[model samples]
Target chain A: MSDPAPQVPPQLAAYRATIDNLDAALIHLLAERFRCTRQVGRLKADLHLPPSDPAREEQQVARLRALAEEAGLDPVFAEKFFTFIVAEVIRHHEAIRDELSE
Target chain B: MSDPAPQVPPQLAAYRATIDNLDAALIHLLAERFRCTRQVGRLKADLHLPPSDPAREEQQVARLRALAEEAGLDPVFAEKFFTFIVAEVIRHHEAIRDELSE
Candidate 1:
């Protein structure tokens, strides 16, 4: 059982249209980010380097926290979000390393 | 005790620069998204509409999942990311509604 949607006012619709476009843009940006990270993973594997770089990750966290504060967003949330993405990237990097070893 | 930073090869340095730019862009986009959502919260409060809309969220989940697949990203990860942002937006909306009621 689902309730029917209420009549969306025009202003709300316009805002949503903009939001949708921004969401699409965000996804594309993320895709590009992962693409770059994947290349890094391959390079690291070829070089016999570790999959994760803690120093670089720490630097990124600090840089992004500052950027988040500048953008009027919560630094903690930004850090959490970045951590989430980094975890995924590391997983991919580890997988790449394992594939190279096999 | 921390590992020393590696001498980054030029190719890796280039990739990191691109990743940093994309991360900054992502943060700005999210800031804009939250800005728009906050306005939506205020308007919903004015209209006495509910803070959370499950039906719309479900629709959005489906839409973004499809978009993620099209972008060659993991749909599950995309859904999880969207769900994370939506949770924050709902919390903001609830706060707005409470403020209006007071």
Candidate 2:
């Protein structure tokens, strides 16, 4: 169950609004990323290539971890986040490969 | 434990690199959002105000779910994402409030 929402004063509403805006931007950004990655998945399927790439994944995780630290975010968390995303991308690629084969 | 990384072909390496770039952009955007939200927390503490706002939270969630739909993302997923972030933001606000008082 979710925690009870707080009772924010009128003056504080603007901050939450800003956060909402930011969240919207995040959604859009993620959509764009997926859109590009989807193309990669299709290309991989077209070439009869495998979905996963451990070396490239490792490189990306390391790069993102460093970048996260530079940006003052937890490297471990950033890596975990990317790991989750990479899994999803591969899943999509696998599905695309199957679809193209059939 | 994380799953073993895939062995991506050379052709796919470029795609992974693009994903990495997009992820970095996401991190930067998140950092910026938190920075703004932090200011709001401080202001709230200064005024001895509470952190959460149920009404605004609901409005934002509804707005985002719609935005997510327009962007081709899952509405339920978007709401959940905001709920998670809101929890974190409230936690931070609570901390700031305590620190200012102490």
Candidate 3:
């Protein structure tokens, strides 16, 4: 009798490829979002407004959680994601402020 | 013969608890950092400066990458972490500006 050959599942490979593409798309969208946010920051500077608004951040997190849930994502995970983003925005804002002050 | 009892290593449990505590500290520090950043944002807005500084962001990323490597972390992963944070800061700055405009 001939030895049997090892077989790999094609479906799993296709699913992985699809996930890779989705990840690329996600990164592209995130970049675009950052660009728009930068423009908004410039506008705020022009208008003499502060960078971090707790109330606004709270609203944003709440809204994003709802949107994530609607899109079939875990709300808790979404909240953690937003928390990380919020921390970064505050850091960038501070850097700009320090530069201008100097 | 009696069935053998399942067992979890106490060391593994202790390690997990330590990791959990570290995560909590990381969150707390991040929050404090954001608070400082927000203060910086306000200072910048008062001085009529923009929210996003590409040069500064690049410098910060470079510094962070080096620090991460020194601490036995993957530089690429550290960069991704910083990228996410930068995006959030820009978004928060924009929101602040929009509020002031209104």
Best by TM-score: 1
Task: Give the Cα RMSD of candidate 3.
Answer: 25.9
Query: By TM-score, is 2 or 3 better?
Result: 2
| DockQ comparison, 1 vs 2, better candidate | 1
Residue B55: error of model 2 in Å?
2.8
Of 1 and 3, the candidate ahead on lDDT is: 1
Q: Look at candidate 3 and tell me the lDDT of residue A62.
A: 77
Worst lDDT window (10 residues) for model 3 chain A? A19-28
Name the lDDT value of residue B19 in candidate 3: 33
Model 3, which residues run further than 4 Å from truth?
Answer: A1-102, B1-8
- Which pairs of residues collide in model 3? A88-B85, A88-B89, A89-B88, A89-B89
Predicted candidate 2 versus true structure: per-residue lDDT over B1-102, tens digit per residue:
776865556766786677767888988777777788789989978887678768767888899899989998767767866776677679888999989889
For candidate 2, give the docking quality class from DockQ.
medium
Task: Report lDDT (CA) for all predictions.
Answer: 0.91, 0.78, 0.54
Q: Show pairs that collide, candidate 1.
A: none
Question: How would you encode candidate 2's per-residue C-alpha lDDT over A1-102 as one tens digit per residue?
Answer: 776865556666676677767888998887778788889989888877778767667878888888888887767667766766677678878989988889
lDDT tens digits, residue span B1-102, model 3: 775743424543453354334333334434444544555555456555577768656766676666656654445756886676567667666666666667
DockQ score for model 1: 0.73
Model 1 misplacement above 4 A:
A1-5, B1-5
Candidate achieving higher TM-score, 1 or 2: 1
Q: How far is A48's C-alpha from truth in model 3 (Å)?
A: 58
